[model samples]
Target: MDMRLLVGRNVKRIRTARGLTQEELAERSGFSQQYLSDLERGRRNPTIVSLWELAQALGATPVDLITPDDHAD
Candidate 1:
């Protein structure tokens, strides 16, 4: 699987698990809602700084955003 897609999926999973809306996460991360949408859709490549900020906003570590999910066979 592509890393970008993996990261996007992780971000979306964590965000939803935390009960945060895209708009809310964007506000907390100081990013635009459109940009957050793009990130979640795997349409944007986030910089390290952006990832850090997003992780902080999501109450997660940066690695959590990029780590691959464990798949069940």
Candidate 2:
């Protein structure tokens, strides 16, 4: 499985669940809107710092964003 896609979908799901827009998440995560869009589209491979920031912005743990649901352990 592609970790990028997994992370992207998880981030998108969580962000939407929190009623946050891409721009809002970007601002909170200290990234550009375009960058956040790329991440949500699974078009960007984020660095560890970026992943941490994104997780924080979404109020999620890095593992929650990166791990596959079935393989969360």
**Best candidate, lDDT-wise?**
1
TM-score of each: 0.90, 0.88
What lDDT tens digits, residue by residue, belong to model 1 across residues 1-73?
6766777888899999999999999899999999888888888888889899999999999999988787311
How much is 6 displaced in model 1, in angstroms? Answer: 1.0
lDDT of each: 0.87, 0.84
Candidate 2 lDDT tens digits, 1-73: 7777778788888999999999899889899999888887878898888888889988999888887866333
Model 1 ranges off by over 4 Å: 71-73
Cα-based RMSD of candidate 2: 2.5
Question: In candidate 2, residue 66 scores what lDDT?
Answer: 84
Distance from true position, residue 8, model 1, in Å?
0.8
Please tell me which predicted candidate would have the highest TM-score against the true structure: 1
Q: What is the lDDT of residue 59 in candidate 1?
A: 99
Off by over 4 Å in 2: 70-73
